[model samples]
Target chain A: MSINKLAYYPGCPSDGTAVDQDMSTKAVFEKLGVELVEVEDWNCCGAAEVEDPKVVYALNARNLAIAEKEDLDIVTPCSICYYNLERSNKALKADEALCTKLKGIDSSLDYGGKIKTKHVLDVFVNDIGMDEISSKLEKKVNVKVAPYYGCYIGRPPETAFDDPDNPVLMDKLIELIGGEIVPNFNYMKTVCCGGPLMMTRGDIAFDMARKILDVAKNAGADCISLACPLCGMMLDGKQADIEKALGITIGMPVVYITQLLGLALGIEPNKLGLNKNAVDTKEILGKVV
Target chain B: MPIKTWELDPNFKNEIMGEAGGERLASCFQCSTCTLGCPITEIVPSYNPRKIIQMSLLGMRKEVLSNPDLWVCLICQTCTARCPQDVRIADVLSAIRRIAEREEEAGNLKIDSPRPLFDKAFQHQLEKYGRLYDIGLAKEYYPKKEGSFIKGMKAMMKDYKDFGMRMFKKGKMGPKAMLAPKVKGRAVIKKIFKEMGEE
Candidate 1:
């Protein structure tokens, strides 16, 4: 069954930092019969912390303006992009004077506030619905996954895509794929991964990243499954760095939730960009039936 | 140890309240919930969110503006989510950082840290190319930052050796895409930044 096409906002990471996320997102969505229509000529979301809120507002507003012109709900695999897009839209709505000034900044573009920003996790849980997703799984992925939601998907009560305190969206998705969630760990829901800030403060970042890894490892998780690419970058890309910094070998591989889902859907592992992960996933894959 | 009397600037709280996103300053009731919920506080015990709010309300202007902890927040909104008073501690801290930037510019405050320089470099890169180029950022940021050419180059090469080689092999960075790939609507983004006086 074919679902309606979404205006996919393949944020900056899609091109650079987290290409595997982009590939798996596309592959899994295609298999699920949902077509992703890339927003034409999209700009960077300016993930770095800016001095002025207006700069971030304007940056995200441009992307929203582009999608509004296309008339489709925007979907993104990156949590920061989803958060910024949603924050910008809300900022515009709150202050009319600021919104008017922003509109006048660029005469060529229009910030109509027409589109709704949805995280890919939300699209899977709410839009695609679990029934359809479960029926499509070709094989049972019996791996134990520590579902790391991070802090972005749900927080700031006003603009959350899921429950802020206890988000079960990823847990449900994990079970549907025949993966077991690490039982009864409240800290698994909303831990900070020290993203973006990791660039300058590797010490703090490694410490924070280590805490998440320690929890998952203690819970006997075979791997960590996450939604945000920034989390993926920290957990997967910096997994080795964290090990070196902490002087402990955490052999668990960090895989994007979509990649794991694609695996359960029986899509070829290479097609999901499983090879690109910094932590080798081959040993784990060998164990999975 | 000598006892110290903090000359309370009652106007400091009012001044912060006057800034954008800082209007909720009066709502905080000295509940330490924000500090308890903060992840940074767990590692860096001296950096306390609830204490920072108390100090800000009590008019600790010089201390609040100059402290490096002001910039350490990830702005993850964890504190904001848990704050019963809707104090928006993250926004308040961000506002303090903005004041710090202004003071640093006027030479009233001197910061010995990498964050401000790095932030300026990130913003400048966006202004020039409408996106972050790591190579460009390193070129533009490191010299003045390290206060010497040799140290800057050494630092940059060390960073490249650590993660750059891996990122390059992963295709996250390359000569073609990282150097000069096609940027769509560069003029429009530049104009947006320019009009905002961010240029």
Candidate 2:
């Protein structure tokens, strides 16, 4: 199951907050001999907050429709995007009424529901294979990494490619790349990052993030590695705020899973956008570099 | 609180079941599994999923729809994943929220949270540019408060100063990123939104 090329959907945040993820994903994949072609003119997948099913289905169907034209399976790094796109793809295929309604939206845009939507993690682990990934690694990462698998990547079971309760693709990938997995990470791996409620309920969101960081730090993790941009926004972007609000000094560096993989592949730090992390990644990068 | 049979809308659960994500609403048997696994409920004890399901089942329409706890869900689907009844608790909540949004739009009830505002702004960005424009979203999401646009802007800046500064320093957010290119199929997106009646 070697994938040579994939249609990439760099969800909204990749263009902004998670730019590091966008950069490192491309860098690591290119090094692994996989080409990621951007899905042409893709739109937002209504990331979790959009409660209206009609709007959610319509938005995701548009992206799936565009990807169907590429004649390639779609892959996204963002967990929310992966879940929504796959959910929409499944619904659009299973529900004939949805397909008809979407057709009414744009007659020229027809999705035969032929394409499979995959998260990049699934592609790297299942399609590319850990053996191939390890062969490409120029450096074996030595830092202790807490592999954080936020919510969307493993929820609702039906759309998830990995185990919803205990996903090991990330752990396997990190281990293959020579990063040590934290012993206590399993408990907090699937916990919510409180991302969707960050805006409306910062108190709860911060507290939730605080717990994850505390667990990671307590387990002697050098850094936390994750997939979702929203999780990165909460864990990496808000680490400082959580510390200040809670009157605690976590100072835990959070890195995108791709960024860590990029480093292990000997891609330059700048190429991986390591410096873009709000929590300084220098300490962990120093150990690997 | 005493039971008020006269105020209950017996068809409320049926109404929820009619919604796209609510097809399984009637299957929940008060097992309390969804509430037990919920992370939000752990922090805010009052925001209970099982209770919401029970209320909807008993046809407590206004009480369920107008509840501010409705928006507190992270929609992480932990409960949905663990539900023995396959209730899809998160999606059911979302379905209820859709009704709440409509109710608020019709001026029948008021939602306390600004989450709906943010969602609208998010959808607006998608419909207008076919992708999210962070700055544009910020401008739309912050409350405009009558005529004090400058005051509102100041407040937002104050709230976001630290976070925005970090993003700006990393070259992730700023005027340059705001002017980043839009997708080529804006027209198609607008047409999709219009057709979906989301416009």
TM-score, first chain, each model: 0.94, 0.97
Task: Give the lDDT of residue B142 in candidate 2.
Answer: 74
Q: Which regions of candidate 2 deviate over 4 angstroms? A: B144-148, B174-176
Instruction: Encode model 2's per-residue lDDT on B1-199: one tens digit a residue.
Output: 8968678999999999988789899999999988898899889999999999999999999999989999899998999999998999998998899889989999999988878887887788878888878777777777532125677587678667888888889867756566845878788778877777543
Model 1 lDDT at residue A68: 80
**Interface CA RMSD, all predictions:** 2.0, 1.6
DockQ, all models: 0.56, 0.69
Clashes (N, CA, C under 3 Å) per candidate: 0, 0
Each candidate: what lDDT? 0.80, 0.86
Candidate 1 residues lying further than 4 Å off, grouped into runs, are A1-3, B1-8, B174-177, B197-199
Report the lDDT of model 2 for residue A163: 79
